[model samples]
Target chain A: MVIVSVAMLILFCMIYLIPGDPAAVALGPRATDAMREGLRIKMGLDKPVWVQFWNFFFAAWQGDLGRDVLSDRLVATVVMEQLPYTLALIFGGISWSVALGIPLGCWAAVERGTMADRIVGVLSVAVIAVPSFVVAIYALLIFAVALRWLPAIGAGEPGDIGDQLVHLILPSLAVGLGWVGYIARMVRASMLEVLESQHIRTARAFGLPERMITYRYALTIAILPTVTLLGVGIGQMLSSAVFAEIVFARPGVGKLVYDAILTRNYPLVTGAVLVTTILFVLLNLLADLIVGALDPRVRSRL
Target chain B: MTVLSIKDLNVTFSTEGGRLHALKDVSFDVPERRIVGVVGESGCGKSTLINAILGLLADNGRVDAGSITFEGEDLTRLGPARMQELRGQRISTVFQDPMGALNPVLSVGRQMRNIQYRSGRSRSEKDARSEAMLRQVRIPDAQAALARYPHEFSGGMRQRVAIAMALMMRPALLIADEPTTALDATLEVATIELLRELQQDIACSVLFISHHLGVIAELCDDVVVMYAGEVVERGTTRQVFHTPRHPYARRLLECDPARQSGRTRHLPTIPGEIPDLRQRPPGCVFATRCDQRVDACDKVPPDVAVETGHVARCVLAEAR
Candidate 1:
């Protein structure tokens, strides 16, 4: 865990050392060369790059993300307020993946080579092959514009979480659709192998109903692999909030960092990056523990 | 009366490639209340023949040319909806692996009760009947075992559970396909004895499929030896083993080391694998594998009467 934190901290410093000047970017097109230089000196950006990087990380450690140069707002405060919205979007997407992926996988497995299974299988493969950003745009155009049922942007007020969730539907679907295909295929292959197993044949020989043989025996064996997917897949689904948040222009941490990087607000960018990296690392650790809980063989090793 | 009468039975599966014949021109009959063992090598169409009789063939599997007459009803012609009524009620099977024969996630009690109630048991009657059947299978700790999953039981216990499940329906005929091959020697004998005991009490006929002629020798009253998708011999177990006329049946018995009298370098083996169904030879399927091959062996062997109840598809036996 400490290694992960230190690794992220080192990466944070390296990104800041890149040659491009964020202060110059912040000053924008209309500013004179003398004025841009003056602003850079005032913000302490004129210092050696290493020194500037150090100060920014120090402020990040102290929770002093500094003010966004353009908005004149505290970066730390802005990010904290937006963090929940991104987390919500991520959770929503993962929930959607789990809700649809498991049952559909089992269904495809039980009804192997059937018309419905074939169609779902093909659709899932298509979902994975096409990028999520494309799915977001198409879904937004269809659901928000063509259908005209949802508000296009924003997480809305605290009390309006349901409406915010409604707005997130298309973007989350775009983000999560592909994982369903991957997880379903994993499940289907497992189910097919397990269904043909000796015990299953033995069960049927006993005159057990088809439903019991399918749901009870075949599905239990099939789910071992699906549970394995859930742990790491959830991390990927939750952490990959950038594209969807950016496309929708939602007030999420991803968009906050986007604004920070553009304005040369180093503290906010470093802080957000650190928090995200840590969250993902911790999420992966939690996944390992949870998946281990489901499979005793791993638990025994621990 | 014959419980199962399969006449000119043929099974063909049309896969993505082309038509593949699985069973061809096979015919046999099971007498009422008797153990009839179908012994053959793997892929000799033993399991396929039984699956066709059970109406449990997969999507691509088809009964290309045959009549499976069970108690006067042509099962091959019965619609799926009509077949379902008879499947768990009057027709049942026990397969190769006992552990797989029951649902891994369900309690044996639940599986037993489900077949009991859904096939027409009331909720109240389901429990009482389920417990009784558990005891009948001789599962120790019947109540606790009933509540446990299939994996919790030993292989022998599981097979007993499977046997109990099959007999719970009190079917007229039970088809078991290599049912104890996965068991240890001790469990194998115990399971076979358990099966015999159950069938003795239930008075149900058994169409037993296996590769072990020794098992058939001990368990079956009559035998049907299959080779390359057709029956090569059928007779009383005594007649088939002692004076087997068909070369394939005789070779099958000759290969069992327990029954071997000579210390030969190698066991007597039927030469080739079961012929590929896609390009079957024009003549007898077994002739390529038969050591008794002659010029006439290239011609289809007619089914010749060897005894009062014995019959064999062998050209050499005809001269006798």
Candidate 2:
């Protein structure tokens, strides 16, 4: 909750720090000076910064995030409109990362010092070193330009779930690629450590099959640390979606925030920031809950 | 009648500094249904001996010589897959730290069930067997304890739970690596006694490893005394305790505070550090700290027979 307040505080201050005339932007440069002044007064842009902030802060508690001066739409409406696209992108990204990362991590750890382990280690390091947007460019060149398998830009038919999924593929990859490398490396390191633990040695002594020991004993323990990384990945994924959405010309919460920031749309930007903060908090909470559920020792500690 | 036999076994670890001779030409046997204790101070390679038999040696540890035969199979030659089949079914192990031995993520019942997967019994039957084993280990409210995690149990209870899990399959031989070292004194005695009773009840041989001589004396039928990665003495517990032939063994017995007869201000301690495995001296490893060291101690010591089955590796033990 305090984080939410801080986010609001930062977002509220961003408008003043940025050099822009919202009234002139809304009325257009060609508008008469008297008309621009009239619009500024009507939109309460002439009010003191603290008074404007105070009004928005109190109204935000009641779910009123104010209206977009340009679109004349409610800030809440714009957020809700673009929220699903952002969420879907984040979900797609996380799924792809986890799907690829975990098994690769287990394989790398089990094959440590082997050719396969080295290859995976190298590939993961490479992916981690390269920025996601750079990877996004290559993905676009291959999948969109060369292969012609996917759309190059803009989200597909808005209400069509299949088109939306198709449109999200490249964007998700753009966001998820780095996370895959991160999660895979974390799982490998964690699995190696867990494999050396006494409990795992005990499990092996129990005459369990090699597969069972690897998956049941080692993987279960190893995956705990990875879950926390995934929680942090959520915030990274959300931010990455801003760039992905911009590159792909898809409108998401990130894209909405990006455009709002560019145009100095205070209400829309503030609303988006608050939502992202809440999502981040919720993701961390979910991670803690999962860890507690997985390990009774941690659960009792909690 | 040997349930587990290790003959001329040598294990070496290739560490960064040098080759560490962890176990040297070690030989021992756990007769059917008998508890043979392997007693030594820390770094004596007692745990390494157990790991060698169980094929749980660390990555760097290499069994350079000899064979470990369980029942009839040569364990050292067996592949990991085949050895795993024999492990827990024919040769289970109870580790030193019960808390560290059991998976923290799993419930006591779940882990027990995992071990019983090969039993091919129904889930309910496995549960019933688990409860029965817990009761056998004398855990009160065995059924309730099943749902509990390892951390929920007291240290003593955890050891019992570990014992119950280990003995559930009734392996032909059970290697207990200081299972009671972590417990308090009262718990230690009770756990040792319980382990003895359970061993008999299951009719399984136990190669019990511990540094605690008192526990070994009370629990073992036979004992092998080790020093610096080599067994210096081997005999029945009565024979070895009543007449420890090796200088190191005698000093070890003397160091036991329980054996003190009179009010002594300072307890007796063996002089000198345990010879480093990497730089073991010529002659006997214990000769440097031997109380009665002579010029003859510079030569390799011979294994001398004290009685029919009793043996000690010492120059003094050898008759002229």
Candidate of highest TM-score? 2
Interface RMSD values, listed in order for every candidate = 3.7, 0.9
What's the TM-score of every candidate structure? 0.81, 0.97
- Residue A131 of model 1, lDDT score: 81
**Model 2, A134-202: lDDT tens per residue?**
878888899999999999998889679899789889989989988889988999999999998999888
Stretches off by above 4 angstroms in model 1 are A1-83, A98-122, A183-224, A263-302, B15-19, B99-102, B105-110, B122-132, B262-265, B279-283, B291-298, B318-320
Q: How far out, in Å, is residue B108 in model 2?
A: 1.4
Could you tell me the TM-score of candidate 1?
0.81
> Taking the tens digit of each residue's C-alpha lDDT, what string does model 1 give over B1-320?
98988899999888776777888888888989999999888888887887788787878899988799998899999986567667766778887877556665556787778677545658657767777788997988777777676766778888888888888879999988898899988888988898899898988899998887778889999998888788889889999989999988888887888887867777766567787887777777788777878888777778888787798998888534
Residue B38 lDDT, candidate 2, scale 0-100: 93
Instruction: Point out the worst 10-residue segment of candidate 2 chain B by lDDT.
Output: B311-320
Native-contact fraction for each model? Answer: 0.49, 0.86
lDDT of 1 by residue, A1-302 (tens): 67554865686667667667656777788888998889878777788966876776677667676776666688767778877877777777767776787778889887778998998799789877988778778878877889887766666656776777787787677677877788778878888898887666655544456777787667766777676666567556644577788887777877877777766666567667666666667666776786666444455568
Please, what are the lDDT tens digits per residue for candidate 2 over residues B111-138? 9999998999999999999999999999
| DockQ per model, Cα | 0.32, 0.80
